[model samples]
Target: MPKKLIQRFSPKPETLKAHPHLKYFGEILQNPNLWHLNRRSAAGAVAIGLFCAWMPIPFQMLLASLLAMFFCVNLPLSVALVWISNPITMPPLFYGAYRLGASILNEPIREFHFELSFHWLAHAIETIAPALLLGSFILGVISAASGYFMLRILWRINIANKWQRRNKK
Candidate 1:
């Protein structure tokens, strides 16, 4: 059931090949494993996506895509998963990460209001950088590992069920 859901939603392999904007990827995108929706590919993509989603940077999808190609994961799924950190979800997730970082480093958490000025933003970032970075790393690792194992288990259960059904017939 999970496999079927993936296949139904995953883009056709040709989608990337035909994309004019993705030309920068050049031949790297040609790797067949990047397009396949198999257990390994899907699991790797999910992991990559989860990892990239926690990154507090621009172009998260691009990063996910590059890593997916390098790791031979499902390219579309890797890119799609980064959307889990979309605008609606960004604030709480990032706050959670910051809190986690503060807890881990045993640092006092500061409460500050948002200031749009460059000086204020830079100062805030400098003060919070350590916590934010550490929290993001920890969260990313945990989520990525969880996603990989969960997908693998789901795949195994799906395959076993298929085999049982086939044998019964």
Candidate 2:
């Protein structure tokens, strides 16, 4: 099986425990289920991470961790996937999400520059926030479901291929 995709980023439980931010989850973060690299856990981790990455808020990684803890997925994988919306990709990703939202809502897609200032935020909230929020939520659901199933299918194929090779041997 192509297990190394996960193992490349999957940190040891002790390594996570040593991280300062994870200290907030207390003993809950230490659960064995949260660290398991099995198919179910890994798929759920991708789903949870994808969903949380679409959130229009700060501390996305923290939120992903919290959701993974709640849903019993691989914690490190959940944290890593939120990098999908990292600063470098944020503008285009969010703009696409906003466009999707506007199209779904049948609202006019607003044209605005991507700016991080408070004035821009306030203006955006008044103008495109509704479409943006709706679009992001919908996109998140779609992304999470896609990631979950994609991982599951790939994992299944990998295992099947491995078994076939072993039988040939």
Tens-digit lDDT track for model 1 on 18-72?
8889877888888888887888898999999999999999999989998998888
Per-residue C-alpha lDDT of model 2 across residues 25-69, encoded as one tens digit per residue = 789977999988889998999999999888888999989988998
Q: Please report the candidate that would top lDDT against the real structure.
A: 1
**Range of the 10 consecutive residues with the lowest summed lDDT in candidate 1:** 1-10
- Alpha-carbon lDDT, every model: 0.91, 0.88
Q: Using alpha carbons, what is the TM-score of model 1?
A: 0.95
Error of 1 at 131 (Å): 0.3
| Clashing pairs in model 1, backbone N/Cα/C closer than 3 A | none
Assess every candidate by TM-score: 0.95, 0.91
